[model samples]
Every structure is written in structure tokens, then in C-alpha cells.
Target: MYCEIEENWRDLDIRYLSFSNICKLNLLILDGERFPILLYDIPCALKVLHWTDCPMETLPFTDHQRYELVEIDLSHSKIVQLWDGKKVLKKLVHLNLSYCKELKEMPDLSGAPNLKTLDLDGCEELNYFHPSLAHHKSLVELNLSGCESLETLGDKLEMSSLERLDLKCCSSLRRLPEFGKCMKQLSILILKRTGIEELPTTLENLAGMSELDLTGLSWT
Candidate 1:
């Protein structure tokens, strides 16, 4: 089952409605100026949640509740943080938070082991990544383009299944992280307009890399 609110609506707060009885409701798409506080009221079987431009700074999911969400897209939302702590999200695969300019923190993703795609492009205030991202084994695509305040991508990246990484326009990042030897599947890497002056030696380990973009980089 799917539920979508009209995009033209304004100030619609559906938090008072209970969705726990809708056991099969799997998709929810909401758009508005005001954010809905329905995380606890929504059923656990929900698989897709798309709530662009929501004004909430945080997702209020209690620590004891577990949801079987597969995809969550809150791009351009006002969220500064996703949640306070890690929740078991074994079924989650895709997450998008692009253009959330006020976003300052990334939640620990150790519980979402199967996550494949993470999009954080244009999040200008985000300066750091959660440490758990360094060891993600199932992630395939990661987009960090336009994160101007980002300086480093942790100490190392060991995502063996990652195939694409986009770091374009990260003007504050001066160095590349050490890539794991097992990252042979990475095929596309974009580092355009970054502050990096030199490439890491581990770039030779990507046996499947077909595209490497280093345009606008200064080799100082």
C-alpha cells in the first residue's frame, strides 16, 4: 500500500493519525513546509519513505522500535541529524539527504549493514563522517559532492563492494583516504574541484576502475 500527499499542500500535520494498523502500508511520500512527527505511529512494515523539504531537525524514532525500511529519501529537509542512536535497519539499502545545508552530523550506520547508496551532496555544513562508514562492506555508491566544509573522509575506506564514489567540489578536503586492497570493484571515482594535491597509492588497487575524474585539482 502507498500513501502520498499532494505537493502543493501547506502546513499539513498528519502525526495524529495512527498507521500501526496498516500492516501492509509500505510506501509513504510527504511534501510540505511543516514536518510530520509520525515515526512512532507508522507501521514497522514500511519500506519506502520520501519526505522532501520537511522542517524537522530530527527523526523521532524510539530506541526500542525497529522498522523494516528499505529506502529513505529526505533530501532538502531541515534535519540537522537523522536520529540520536543506531537502530537495527538490516533491510535498509538507500538513503538520500542531499542539500540539507544545516546538517552537521551523520548518525552511526553500523546497524544498516546492507546499505548500498548514500547521497549527501550539497550538505555544506557537514564536516565529518561517522566512523562506521569506513568499514561498510555492502555500500556501492557514495555521493559527497559539494560538501565544502568536509576536510577528511575518515582515516580509511574499506568498502569492498563500493563501485562509485563522488567527491566533486569538496574544496576543504586536502587528502584522500587509504582505500582497502579488497576494493577492486570500484569503477567510478570523481574528485573534481577538490583540495587534494596528491592521490593515494592505493588507487592502483582498483582493478575495475573505468572512470577517474581529477579535473580542476591542483597538484601542489
Candidate 2:
């Protein structure tokens, strides 16, 4: 089953719904000004959760309940964090949190082993990344463009399958993590308008690199 609440509905309360009858629901798309305080009643079989402009700070589901989810897009929301601690999302593949200006924390991706795309563009408040991100081998595209508060990306990245990495406009970031030797499939790397002064020698490992944007970068 699929349900989509129109974006014009500014004051719809999810608490009044009968969740018991919607146990088999698979897709839910909500665009509203404010969301319910808790989302624990959402169906366990849900696969797609696209809630743009949501006002919630955190998601209220356990690891077991979110296991079936395949894609999640909470762009333009006010979420500071997704949930507490690490949650296993084995079936999750795509996650988009773009333009979530208040976002500061990221859950561990060690549990989401098959995750392919992660979009965090315009997340201005995010400064630190979860350690698990450095070793996520299944990620194909990772975008951190416009993350003005970001300073570093740990010491090294080991995502062998990553194809594109966008770090444009990260004004506070001065350095990049060393790319792993297995990252031969990386094709695009955007580093426009960042604080980085030098490139790591490991960059030579990306044999498939087709685009490397260095516009607005100042060399030391």
C-alpha cells in the first residue's frame, strides 16, 4: 500500500490514524510543516519513507522495525539526528538528507552494509562524521557539498565502490582523507570552494577519474 499526504496540508496529525489496519503499508510520502512527536506506529513493512520539510528532530523506530526500509528521503527537515545509537538497516540502499540545516549527527553506517547513495548537501551544521563512514565499501555516491562547518574526513577513506564524491563549498575543511587503493572506480570528485591546500598522493589510485573540479581553490 502507498500513502502520500499533499504538501499543502499544514496541520495533519498522524496520531488519529489507524495503524493496525495499515500493517502492510510499503510506501509513505509526507510533506508538512510539522510532524507527529513519535513515529513508532509506522508499519514495519514500510520500504520508502519520503518526508520533506518535516519538523521532527529524531526518528522513533527500532532497528528491527526499519530493517525492511529500502529508501529514505528526509530532505529539508529539521532533524538533528536520525535515531539514538546504531540501527541495522540491511535493506536500506538510498538515503537523502539534503538541506537539513539543523542536522549535526549521523548514525553509524556499519549496520547498513548495502547502502549505495548518501546525499548530505547543504547540511551546514554537520561538523563530524560517524567513524563507520570511512569504511563503507558499498557506497557509490557520497555528496557533502555546502557543509560549511565540516573540518575533516578522518584519516582515510576505504569505499572501493564509490563513483562520485562532492565536497564543494566546504569552507572549513582543510584536508582530505587518503583514498584507498581499491577506489579505482571513482569517476568524479568535486572540490570547488573548499579550504584544502594540497591533494593526497593516493589520488593517483583513481584510474577512472573523469572530472576533478578545483575551481576557487587557493594553492599554498
Candidate 3:
């Protein structure tokens, strides 16, 4: 069949995709229903993969696996666990899992050294953040807006590369991180409509920040 290479994924509606066939495509988006297929042979050229509204309870990705995937968006899905601290996705830069209500904990991300941004908006069931995220020497942006169930940020979260952080609607968060020294790289920090009563006096240490959003945080 002389099908155009550009049209390869145009008609993959909702069926079990044989790894060998779809593994070479640069982009893959799965919707409709979640199919059971393990051993994802991510294409060497794949740059983005989105699993919208799929009902996957567990992901079987391992840390030893190697690939060139960069963006992963699992918004509006049912992924429950990434189990244990293993991040084989070395090249991933952006990760979005907004509105995943069944998601519970943040995956241990010490292995994804190059990861720069993560978006976990609206994960109502989420309760904690990964402790190793601070170790991500390249992490720059993080969006935790609408993670209403999250209670605390784990210890050791001092990322020199962190620039922008958004925590809007984190209703249960009572305290913010304490960064006392000059943060020349820190820029934007958002905390609107949350229950937070105060900001760390370390606010003065934010040397390079251009905008700080603390619109609705009042103990009164």
C-alpha cells in the first residue's frame, strides 16, 4: 500500500496499535477508550504523545528504557500509578496530566535529569509532590494550579534552575518553600485563591523575579 507517510496516523481511530506499526511515528494521540498494550516502543523521532480521557490505571514504563520522547500529555485520564522512583524518559521536557482525578502521588523523577517543566493542574486526588524534583538541575517551570488536595511540597526543593512556579487553588497548602538566599534565576510565582496565610520572608531574596502572584492568600 502506497499510503502517504504523513497520513500514517490520520485514521488510527480507536484500536490496539501494534507497536511495530505506530512506533515509528513522531506523534501519537490516544482517545476514545484505553487499550491494553504494554512495551511502548516509542519512536526515535516521537516528540509528543497525548492520552486523552483514557482509563489506564497503571503505566508499566521502566527507568532503563531509552528513547527520544519529549512531551507527554495525559490530561483527563485515569492513570493511577507510575510506581517507585524510575524515570527512563531522559529527553522529556514537558509533562501535563491535568484533571487526572485518580492520580495519587508524584513519580520519583531523579532519572529524568533534563526535565524542565511539569503541569499537574486539577489533579484533585493528588496529595504529595516528588521530593527529587528539586534535584532536577534543569527544571525551570512547574504548574500545580488546581491541585486542591495537595498538602505539602517535600523537602530538598531548592532548584537553581527553577524560574516560574504556579500554585493557584492549592487550597490545602499552608506554607511555601523557604528560599532565603538571593535567587537570581527565580522569576514568576503564582498563588491565587489558596488558603496560605503568609509568604516566606525569603520573598526578599527573589532577585530576578519579574512577577509574583499572591492575589487571594489572606489569613484574615
**lDDT, each prediction:** 0.88, 0.86, 0.73
Candidate whose TM-score is highest: 2
**lDDT tens readout by residue for model 3, 1-220:** 1112233456764345444355456676655445644345445556676767756666655446676679888888887875556757788898888888889988888777888888888998898787787556788888889989888886335777889988999999888877735355779988888778787777777888999887877853
Q: Candidate 1: TM-score? A: 0.91
| Global fold similarity of model 2 (TM-score) | 0.92
Distance from true position, residue 50, model 1, in Å?
0.6
lDDT by residue (tens digit), candidate 2, 1-220: 8777775555866556544347788888776636463355456788988888888888877654555789999999999987778887888899999999999978888888999999999999998788899889899999999999999999998888999999999999999999888889899999999999999999998889999999999983
In candidate 1, residue 117 scores what lDDT?
99
Which scores higher on TM-score, 1 or 3? 1
Instruction: List the candidates' TM-scores in order.
Output: 0.91, 0.92, 0.83
- Alpha-carbon RMSD, candidate 1: 2.2
Better structure of 2 and 3 per lDDT: 2
C-alpha RMSD values across all candidates: 2.2, 2.1, 3.8
Q: In model 1, what are the clashing residue pairs, if there are any? A: none
RMSD of 2: 2.1
Answer with 2 or 3, whichever has the higher TM-score.
Answer: 2
Count of clashes in candidate 2 = 0
Q: Relative to the unseen true structure, what is the C-alpha lDDT of residue 149 in candidate 1, on a scale of 0 to 100?
A: 95
Provide the lowest-lDDT 10-residue window in model 1: 33-42
For 2-43, candidate 1 gives per-residue lDDT tens digits of: 888774545755656566778999997876536465655557
